[model samples]
Every structure is written in structure tokens, then in C-alpha cells.
Target: MLRDIDPMGDQASIIGGVIEFIKEVQQVLQSLESKKQRKSLSPSPSPSTPKSLHLPAKPNPMGEVGACFNSSLADVEARISGSNVLLKIVCQQIPGQILKIVAVLEKFSFDVLHLNISRMEETVLYSFVIKIGLECQLSLEELATEVQQSFFSEPVFLNEI
Candidate 1:
């Protein structure tokens, strides 16, 4: 004899499982949508601002630096002297945290020349190339030290975005 199945118990189990699955899907969808929104909201440079801007030249440490009456010339020379420094960093995927990295660069007087980001399964990797001008007093070592001390000190989560 086949025992009759309890319809109420079976129905309740199915309904409960469906509800749980729906909640999980909602959470994952929300996370992905938030990430998209954060990326879209990032501020882009204005058209008026040139792709590369230069700082004034300074004394070469061993020789006197010549002055140029034209500000454009001075700007161009400064940029020519200050090439970009490339760095790679890996961190937990987080939204709105790029600003913190930018802040660190600004603190060290490094101009952000270019930035590229890649997202892996569990990590967000940043590749940044920056230029430091002669006007900036900090050396490469000092800048790197400061950035490491400030930005990489703690693990960052994506809760802010």
C-alpha cells in the first residue's frame, strides 16, 4: 500500500524554498546593479581640461633652470620631464573606493596620467600610471611609501556604494 503524501507539508516546503531562492536572487541582482550605477556615476574630465597638463619647471638640482616667458612652453617642458610611474594593486572589489586611491596620489603630488581597472572573480585590480613634476617635493620612494601607508593599510569593502 502506498502511503498518502501530506499535501500541506509538501506545499509548505516548496513555498519556503521558493521564497529563499527569490531572496538570494534579489540580493545578487541588487549588488550587480549597484556596481553598475557606481561606475556610471564616476566623474569624467571636462573638455576644457587638456588630456595632459604640465607644471612649471624648477632647478635641476645641479644646474639653474631656465625660465620661459610663455606659460605654455613652461608647461610643456614640465610634462616632458615628468614621465609616468606605473603601479599595480589588488584589492577587494569595491565601489567608490577609487576616489580613495586618487586622494592618495593627490597627497603625494602625483598627477594621474592614466588608470585601468580589471575585475576578477573576487578581486579588483588597479593599474595606474602617474606623473610627478619637478614642483613636487616628494621622490618616487617617498610617494610610494606614503601611498602604501595610507591606502593599503586596511581591507576595504564595497558597502559605501
Candidate 2:
């Protein structure tokens, strides 16, 4: 006899977490490969053709760092005003991801005021507005850098797209 499946139970949650972890691992590996390719030259030996006869290969428009955020993956943003800080992170479902983010926030002296978590398919979106007491002393730039460094393995540059 076939048993009924419950999507809200522990077993289902464990499987989903495993799938998310695997996806993140694959993303990191692909990023490493792209970096290596950008750093190394073509392995083929030099051709005998005259320099005038051969055309130079076009460079990769994306360059060495490549795309930092994939639309299908994740995006992180931080907004600051006085002692109020708002952080928005939209990402694929990752195991213990929210806890990790919260831990980092605590280290930076930001107290979580409110948190909203919404799920779409396998993605989890987190919206947090935090408050820092007068005693908390960290500039916005420093806070932003710390957030990226703790949450991301790669160096992230903010660009308006």
C-alpha cells in the first residue's frame, strides 16, 4: 500500500533543505570555474600564422568577476537612515539562512524590529527593518561591507542596474 505524503512534515522539509544546499554548492563551483577561466589563457600552442593574418579574440564582456547575482538566485540590499536600518534579501531557500543573517546582524549591533518572510516556489524572501541604539557606532559603509562579507563568499560591488 502507498502511504500519503505530507509536505509540511519533517521529512519533506529535510529533503527541501538538502536540495537547496546542493543548488548553492553548484552555484559556488560554477563561479569558481568562471574565475579560473578568466585568469588563464588558452592552452593551445601558439599558431605559426603571421600576426597580421590572425584576428584577436574578443574579450568576455562580463570580465573576470562575472555576474554577482543571478535573477534566479538571490539579491541583497540595505537601507540606512539615522539609527534605522532596513535590510532586504531575496534568495532561494537555504537551510538556516535566516538564522545566519540574524546572527550577523546581531554582531553589527542592529536589533531586529520586524521580520517578514515569504516563500515563492523554492525561494525565500526576507524583509527586515532594524534599529540601532545610540550606543551602536558603525558607519553605513562599514555595515554594508560587513553584511556582504559575512553573507557572501565573493566580493560584491554595488551597482545600479
Candidate 1 at 160: error in angstroms?
12
Q: What are the Cα lDDT values of the candidates? A: 0.49, 0.53
Q: For model 2, name the residue pairs that clash.
A: none
TM-score of each: 0.40, 0.45
Candidate 2, 11: how far from true, in Å?
40
Q: After superposing candidate 1 on the true structure, give the runs of residues whose Cα lies further than 4 Å from its correct spot.
A: 1-82, 152-161
Scored by TM-score, the top model is: 2
**Local error of candidate 2 at 17, Å?**
30
Residue lDDT tens for model 2, 22-97: 6655544554454346437444323332111112222234331111222223455555644567666666576656
